[model samples]
Target: MAEQDGAIYDRLTRVPERDWDKNAGLDALLNGAREPFVLRGFVADWPLVQAGQRSAADARRYLLDHARDRPFTVSIGPPGHDGRLFYDADMAMNFRTGTGKLGDIFAGIEASEAQDDPRTVYLGSIDIPAHFDGLDEANPIDLGDRDPLHSVWIGTRTRIAAHNDFPDNLACCAAGRRRFTLFPPSQFRNLYLGPIDNTPAGRAVSMVDFDAPDLAAHPGFVAAMAEAQTVELDPGDAIFIPSMWWHHVEGLAPFNILVNYWWRDTPAWLGQPQEALNHAILAIRDLAPEDKAIWREMFDHYVFANDGRVTDHIPPAARSVLAPLTSESAGRLRAFLLRALNR
Candidate 1:
């Protein structure tokens, strides 16, 4: 429990190890979670996690033995930069990045006492199959019909600022440990979002520094953190983060490695809702306030509510655009939107 000096009543709800299994219980929670919760022994048996139980060096060797000769991009920052990677005053990215051999980078990590001095040097997302051949065989988890998009993240004592991902993520702490402070998407307004087009860690991150809060500068972050749920993970534990949930990640050990499986709940035919949101910002953001309110109601009726009664008045045969979206209808709608945008 990473609580304040004498604070009581941890914000996160923790469920014990024996309560949930990986199949139905885990799937149900991932599908319909309203708040973040921790499953105690979700991945305690992974070989990587087992190696980590011995020592951090042992875990590093295990992963390195499986890796290929592929080069990986690394993020580097000076010691005492306090672990948080972000944009500096000049709007330049705080951390420097370069590509190098996986073995060479790991050697550097092993040689340095990163926890004592604290430099940010890590690989963000290395494709598991591409870099570590047959690694998935060592640690298998069922994602069912959806073949997950898997990646490996290895780094030193570093912190990734609050950010949201597009797909649902299952992050397994295979080596070292981590603490995740998560907030719901509804707190987007209070999170102090950065530039959408340019980002440090491949996504729009929050400007607020949770480790050292500048309360005067970002007053809204107080509200956001108040709603946050913090979960500390040891090696072998895993967390399922639903899509669009904002999370700030901290690597709690000198050398850290995590494997993540990303998948969408919806079928492949459905387009990314974030793309539609970007288009909406372009088309509807500057409208008159009254017109904006009317459009909001229209959107609620069409997209949010899913109220079949509103469209029951129209005959099914005549309901072309408003019909239930089957694969064929979705394809037609996509084509129609493309044509409209092209004009």
Candidate 2:
């Protein structure tokens, strides 16, 4: 398959798998390396997985019984989109979104199955605790004291284009199967990134379609594919995606649901480095080549390789801007940026 298609490279890496247990040693897995890894049998004993093993109807019942009849957001698209939700020619979403009850979506799924229809419905990223009250208690992953924000994605054979999330993620398969094609942050240049301000998804997505990639249009995508790794997860299986790792997700089965936990290890005061990069581009990108070269050295010395000695040459009392970055210091920086921008 890889040889025939230039988008699917033959020498792609594989994600390491770990067995699920009460003591899964997640801290070691998370803290040691920022690489993606899977945990087999992670949520194997959850009621949702058991129900999925029985039948789609059983899984639907388990969810409806837990979440009740509350209205949730659902996205609908024609088969032309091929279950891939993304932007069209005018930068508008190819699909449309509407709020509806969960039962309506499940019924739509069943009806579509019976009729062999091409229209698809998706209830993506619904808050578990807010919508489904008692569901979290029934199925828990035991992530220790750190309470991660939980969300669920329910759909039928959907594909999400390659995009990166800011927080570290644990995506657990509750029902059906999923395939993830992951690329490291370094592959960003070859991915053909789309608009930053306007996006179909929350983040800037790659214009190249993974399933039917047009190599002629996006030649650099071949290089990105060479560095890509694909992983398939069954019900009860889970995968950890480190922050800023680009991933393309595909839900394989007719009826599927994924529960994911997202959390960040860094302090909130540190903020997102992506924002800083955007600001740097605005402030420094248009400078003369010589000026830019000089700024690069300044950044390297002060920002990248400053191991506590970059500002050591300056008196501690006078190093107000270069001082240690505490929450108060961050607030002061924010105020300075606000004032500079307003001017």
Candidate 3:
């Protein structure tokens, strides 16, 4: 909506923001980007954006009208939370989740906005087709050939900690303004990640508080801040977050809604790397030091640093699982793991 400078958040660099590229292929740029970027007013013509521009009430009505008769899972934070959804001192989640309709959440946000200390009413990651049915077709962003799983995030004045997603994201500021502070995948070490298996959300988030980071407590964050890129997007603008890029998001307005499309560039049949990571923890984390060294070399040879000649000692046909994985072979491998893990 307006030109912005990332002078805040320790003077983080601003993400590259510009109008959509029509000459160079849009699909390729979004799917293959190694960095994050803002597509300014990319979804300006969306009905939701137009409705939101008119009034908050108009936006709320538009969503309710499009929404199906399905109960939504809502996350509610206590008053004075400053809309940060996170764990308490005991490592328990600070907020509580419950079932509610969209109207309830809208009312709660409106009510919270009026209060001295505001409660966080966040409706996060509801699948569009399941919840809103025809919203995607109605307010569409042509993703070219990509068939994505669209999800809607509606909330008010929320702080979502820095986290990465497996799939690349196209986050549209459908209604209100949003500020995203991003870190590259290489800055993973500096993010101060929490327990992987035990997270408030599915993804592990950085423990550092963006509002007031305790630098001494999290010394690594100082380094992270050096590499950070921040951007503020107004209604109708969108941002593309590449897979594994860390982002801490903020819902800036009293009544806010974001529609994001997520899709992996890989084949749908491919399993998540997280599952393999979890399995490795169970089987390998505490292995004898000497044995661990052996496994590390083996992983590097077969997976990480393999140049297709690691199995040259064996005949090509005899390589079995060492061969390049086709869809059928991947299925077989997955099935084998299920049986082995079950035993």
Model 1 misplaced regions, further than 4 Å: 1-18, 22-25, 28-31, 114-118, 306-310, 313-318
- Best of the candidates, TM-score: 3
- Candidate 3 runs further than 4 Å off: 1-7, 21-25
Q: Would you estimate the TM-scores of all the predictions? A: 0.86, 0.89, 0.94
- Encode model 2's per-residue lDDT on 1-343: one tens digit a residue: 3213634434567778865456754665667458989998888999889999998889999998998567899999887566888887797988999988888778888888875556767888899989997888888877765568999999987888899999989999999898888999999988999988677657889988776778899899888988889888899999999899999888888888899999887777776777887888899999999999999999998888976777878898878868778788888988898899899
- lDDT of prediction 1: 0.80
Minimum summed lDDT over a 10-residue window in model 1 is located at: 1-10
- What's the C-alpha lDDT at position 184 in model 1? 88
Per-residue lDDT of model 3, residues 1-343, tens digit only: 1112234643668998856664454776675677888888788889999999998889999999988888999999998878889999998999999998778777777665678878888889999999986788889777888878899998878889899999999899998889898999989888899989889789999999877778888898888888988888899899999999999998888878999999888998888998888888888889999999999998888889887678878898887677877798789888998899888
Off by over 4 Å in 2: 1-11, 68-70, 287-291, 307-309
Q: Predictions ranked by TM-score, top down? A: 3, 2, 1
lDDT of 1 by residue, 61-93 (tens): 888788888788888988877667889888789
Q: What is the lDDT of residue 99 in candidate 3?
A: 94
Q: Candidates 1 and 2: which is better by TM-score?
A: 2
For every candidate in turn, the CA RMSD to the true structure comes to: 3.2, 2.9, 2.8
